[model samples]
Target: MPQLDISPWPMVILSMIAALFYFIQLKLLNFTFYNTPLSKPMKTQKHKTTWELKWTKIYLPLSMSQ
Candidate 1:
């Protein structure tokens, strides 16, 4: 095999560092960008009546239940 003029160790180390950096960047980007926000969509009704019914049932007074 023909001899290389420069040692390949520095290139190898640089490539490894670059790869690690890219992986971390992609991980951070996906975490921030891919997750949907918890806000209700515009088309869906807020359903305030349903929420009130559920909560009222969940916290009904003992006297009321008797």
Candidate 2:
């Protein structure tokens, strides 16, 4: 039978917690914020083409007798 030693685990856990707090403090101290410029509404134009103004017709081959 063998016993596992975990005496160093407490020190490691404390160091990790200290590092987390240090990073959190740095993030809070160096925080920056900026306001975005407001965008203006754009105007849309409506126009018609020459093709739409002319009338078109389509003939079917099945309607014609042979």
Candidate 3:
């Protein structure tokens, strides 16, 4: 076999590191969001992820402040 090509190893390592960081960030966000004292917990995961909610949160503040 030809000498193992080491060129791709860096990318593989970087991808693994990126995945690790993403999961870490997700876990932190989940704990912070879900444990909040809301009267009614979110009915669905999409309730927060939907673009409309995110847009409204971002838009309302700017409109009100202006």
Using all chains and alpha carbons, the TM-scores for the candidates as numbered come to 0.39, 0.44, 0.45
What C-alpha lDDT do the candidate models reach, one value each? Answer: 0.80, 0.88, 0.78
Q: Per-residue lDDT tens digits of candidate 1, residues 1-34?
A: 9987678889999999999999999899878546
Model 2 stretches astray by more than 4 angstroms: 33-66
Candidate 3 error regions (>4 Å): 33-66
Candidate 3, position 62, lDDT: 50
Q: Model 2 over residues 1-66: C-alpha lDDT tens digits?
A: 889999999999999999999999999889876789899897886678877898877666997976
Task: Return the candidate ranking by lDDT, descending.
Answer: 2, 1, 3
Q: How does residue 43 of candidate 3 score in lDDT?
A: 78
Q: Which 10 consecutive residues of model 3 have the lowest summed lDDT? A: 54-63
Best candidate according to lDDT: 2
Report the C-alpha displacement of residue 13, candidate 2, in angstroms: 0.6
